[model samples]
Target: MTVERTLHHFPLDPASRQVRLALGEKRVAFHEVAERYWERRPELTRLNPSGMTPVLVETDGGKTLVVCESRAILEHLEEVTPEPELMGRDLAERAETRRLLQWFDRKFDYEVNGLLLHEKMEKRLLGLGAPDPANMRAGREALRAHLGYVEKLLTERDWLNGRRLSLADFAAAANFSVIDYFGDVPWTDFPAARTWYTKIKSRPCFRPLLTDRWPGLAPVAHYDDLDF
Candidate 1:
C-alpha cells in the first residue's frame, strides 16, 4: 500500500531546505507545494495556524497527520524512518547535533539570514524596494563570524557533531545554500568551510536544489558546479 505525502515549502527558505534534505536523504517519496509563505495564504494557516513553511502531511489507511514547522517535521521523519540515522548514534552526539541545529536556526539566522535574505530576497519577493546596503553589510559581516565558527568545528571534527554526518550538517548547509544561491558566500576566503560545503553539495539529494531557479533571478554561475 502506498502512502501519500506532501511537503509545503518555500524554495529559498533555509528551514524548508532542511526538511527537503532530510526527506531526500531518507528516500521518502513526496511531492512539493511551493508556497509563498509570506503571503499568509489560507491553505498554509489551515495546516498550521501560525502559517509556517515546510509543513509535512502524510496520509495512510484513511488517517492523516499534519506536521508543522521544520524541527517537528524533521523529528517526525526520523521517528518514522530510523534507518540511515541522521541524528547520531550516541546520546552526546545527538545532543551536539541538536545544539548546532539550534545555533544555525536561531542565532545564525538572526544575525545573518535576517539581514541578508529578508532584506534582499524576501523584500524583492514581496514587491518591496531594493535591499538596504546597511543590512547587506551587516549580513556579510555576521556571515564571516558564523563561517569562522564552522571552520573551527570542521578543523576539529569530520562533521559538525562528530565523525558521522548528522542533522547538524544538513541544518548548517541548508542555511549556507541560500546565501550561496546569491553568490553571497565568498568561498575563496573561507577554504575550510568551502571544502565542507563541497562534500555536501555532491550528494544526490542536493541535485534538485542545484536546479532551482528563481523567476527573474538566476543563481551564481558556479552554484550547480560540484567541483566549485
Candidate 2:
C-alpha cells in the first residue's frame, strides 16, 4: 500500500487553504484533518508546539513535517514539488516573490486580520470574547489603505510582485477572501485592486478554496462567484 500523507489543517484558515491550493495545483493527494485553531485543538498543539495549522504529517514514515508557519510550509512545498511552479523558477524572481509574500503576510494581515476576523469570527470561535465594534470599524478603515497598495502594484505589473502569479498572489488572495466573507472589503474604492483580485480569485486552483465555509457563518453571495 502507498503510504498516505495527511494534511492536518483547517479548511477555512487562509494560510492552510493556500497549502491546499498549492497541493491541489500539484495534484498531490492527501487526507485532510479539519482542525480549527481558534477552538484550541490539543492535537494541533501537540503536533506543533506553536499550535498552528498546515501541519503535513507523513503518517506512513513517521517523518512528520509540522510546518508551524504558513510561509515555511509554502517554501517546503515549492522545494519538494517543483512542477507547475507557484513560486518563480529562478532564484532572483523567487526572492522578489518571497519579499512580497512576507509583506502581504505581515503588513496586510496585521493591519486587517485581527481587526476584522477577531471582531467578526474569532470571538465566536475563541468562545470567551465579545464582539468589539471598535475593532471592526477600524478594520474597515484599514482596508482602504491596504487596497491602495494592492491597486498600486496591480497598476505597475500584472501581479503583485513579479511578472508571474507567485505565492505572493495566493497569500494576498487568501487574506482578501477572508475579509470579503464579512463583506468588509470596500471594492468600489479600488477598482484596480478589484480587477486584479478578480483574476487571482478566478484561477482554477483557487475555486475549491473559495467555496469553504464555517458552521454558523454563511459567506457572502460573492464568495463562490469567480467573476465577482
Winning model by lDDT:
1
lDDT of 2 by residue, 1-228 (tens): 455677888776777877877877777778888887766688888878878787887544654455566888787778877887888867987887888788777777787886887778877877757888888788888878888888888888877766887888888888888888878888878998888888877777787777778898888997788777
Judged by lDDT against the true structure, how good is candidate 1? Answer: 0.92
- Model 1 ranges with Cα > 4 A deviation: none
Error of 2 at 198 (Å): 1.7
lDDT for each residue of candidate 1 in 1-228, tens digit (9 for 90 to 100): 677899999888999999999999989999999998888999899999988898999999889999999999999999999977999999999999999999999999999999998886888888889999999999999999999999999999999999999889999999999999999988888888899999999988888899888787778898999998
The per-model lDDT (C-alpha) reads 0.92, 0.79
Query: What overall lDDT, based on C-alpha atoms, would model 2 receive against the true structure?
Result: 0.79
lDDT of 2 at 142: 85
Give TM per candidate. 0.98, 0.90
What lDDT is reached at residue 38 by model 1? Answer: 83
